[model samples]
Target: MAGNTEPLSPRAKLAVTAGKAAAAVSRAAGRGSGSVIGGRVALKLDPDLLGRLAQHLDVILVSATNGKTTTTRLIAEALRAAGPVVSNALGANMPAGITSALAGGSDAKFGVIEVDEKYLAGVARDTTPKAIALLNLSRDQLDRAAETRMMAEHWREGLSGSKAVVIANADDPLVVWAASSSANVVWVAAGQAWKDDAWSCPSCGGVMQRPGDDWFCGQCGFRRPAPSWALNGDYVLDPHGSAWPIHLQLPGRANKANAATSAAVAAVFGVPPQVALERMYQVQAVAGRYDVVTFQNRELRLLLAKNPAGWLETFSLIDPPPTPVILSVNARGADGTDTSWLWDVDYTQLAGHPIFVLGDRKLDLAVRLEVAGLDFRVCETLDEAVQYAPPGRIEVIANYTAFQDLRRRVGN
Candidate 1:
């Protein structure tokens, strides 16, 4: 059925938008195919139609640099444990994507969505979610996003005067500042080794200093407090390969942060800590982000590295015994607007591992890998790259667009 089938009235458009919001409200529903907003399709729907569509459904905008997808999925899962929920559990985080996900469901009380920071204000103005869960902010996709400040400003402006409960990461300076400014704020603290030490205070241009767990501007003395619900202990991996102690589903410390954010957001819905943690261990990673599949009796791990930050975070997870790795970089407009952020990703960690480069931009990755002075075998065909990569232990790191192509080539 066409997800957007509605009458031409303003109220009809709003109902359609709310229906899309419903699709996102539950994890059981996959992404509805009707709302494709990335390129030319974004122009398919009229602005008035789109604005009216946003008027329906209880939208929950979950925005962050890293943990958005996992957190969004986890929040939906936790809410489901309590009762029925609708969510855009799929990786579609934009307006059309959220709309598409929202179109499939009939029964849903809540709509949990992972919104793109660039479009957060617009979506907020349209849908007006019940709660805005602001995860930590960091540098990502500099070309399209411009800078962290721009996105932060847009987020602050989009959420102005909304009664949506503000769930924020208190450890992050940008998030803490934004959350503290809101009267209806619930702070979530998390222990992350990599704090925003590099960014200076936006006000007074003074050095940003960590006076305790809390951070303040050395120049302006603007302070942001710690999170109320913080994960302060050591993280132990689950033996079964799930994200935690259940199955080995999610890998890497970054996933742990994702898990922590999920737990905190779940708590906001009154889901018990034990239930949240249990659900977290039970859920599997969504298709492209750190998904592992077996092909030809060999282990192939597919990790999505969209931006420099995501790439670096994945790199940190490679506690290597020198395995063969295949890295693909594709900038299909759906994946991103620019692919130049590869320079910011630290490929040095993979120096010990033999690398195979593929994709439409194979040469770019090869040149970058070579500039880093690492050894790699470059191939134009994904099959050839898979054949030439590590025989028994293989790791494939791909951006969004290249994943399906690689999966098909490797026969998984």
Candidate 2:
């Protein structure tokens, strides 16, 4: 004879216990979603369950060579002001990172993830975002990505599967030409004088030159018309005499572009210009790129100099007369096979500053410093470099891996 009451199975009892445990942990943490790390583990344990949980959220995918992290974080923060948002805010822009972030969130209306160009297609395949922003691409890490042309080809393929509304930088001829194929695209560009780089029309391989601030090709004559949303003038704050000022804690000319691009993305998300401007002003700086960290009676300015483009822009921001510099060369294999890009950077600007070069590739950096006719001293260790660095004014420039090493050594 069967009992009138149903007995709980072993699996059912385990599920109930797990639910109770999760609730307890959530209360203990004093935060919602319990713990994202635990949630990631749970998703890794069961993908089907994770997918079921993530079906309702809208996704936004943001990509670019530079400024992706800052833009992603800014967008996430602005979206948060509007409603609930889940984001991979820690510069984990890979497909695996995105998968983990999405799986970790228990309740969110949307998901924003920055995607690295190398992995953009893979990410696009997995999550079809409602909107996607493609910032300009520059010559960076040639050994890793081969050439800018190859990177363009990758993006050309990567964007095919995207169903989202595409937002692109029109100032970059290559970016615009590559993205023109997308029917639903919004162009966000800077003023005409801002066209300093694109030498050829990606559309027809025609030699292109800037006539005033407008770019036009000689062969195919592909010209980028004025943008729907364009920022004019050199000042990041009020490029067009607007009430909103471009306030950024990040230093450099590149950061101005980063801030503009972030504002464009935020605009698309329905953030009011006033609110977005306020958000931009509120941001002091990201962790590593031009980040200022204070120690016990010591100040450290972490300037990220990954490649020629980054360095050129970064050095331009050191104001009120230049100071002494500490240069840390890249040692990581991923930085690039060829370290010859140093010649392209303007080392002459630091002529007065006594430079202290340190890193695994300290010899290479020292040789470049000498060749550039800049004052320099070689140091075998970061500690030696820091110890020798003048007390009053010293700026530290490091590539990605070297910055990490220096940070660890400096106790930052």
* Global lDDT scores for all candidate models: 0.66, 0.66
Cα RMSD to native, each candidate?
A: 6.3, 7.7
Report the CA-based lDDT of candidate 1 relative to the real structure: 0.66
Misplaced by over 4 Å in model 2 are 1-55, 191-197, 233-243, 320-322
TM-score, cand. 1: 0.82
Kindly list the per-residue Cα lDDT of model 2 for residues 302-370, writing each as its tens digit.
877777756766677664334667889875775775787776777887877768988888898888888
lDDT of 1 by residue, 198-314 (tens): 367754567888766667787777767645555544342221223333222577666666666666666566776567777777667675566678766667887777777677777
Q: Estimate each model's TM-score.
A: 0.82, 0.81
Q: Each model's number of backbone clashes?
A: 23, 2
Query: In angstroms, how far off is 412's CA in candidate 2?
Result: 2.7
Q: Which candidate is the best by TM-score?
A: 1
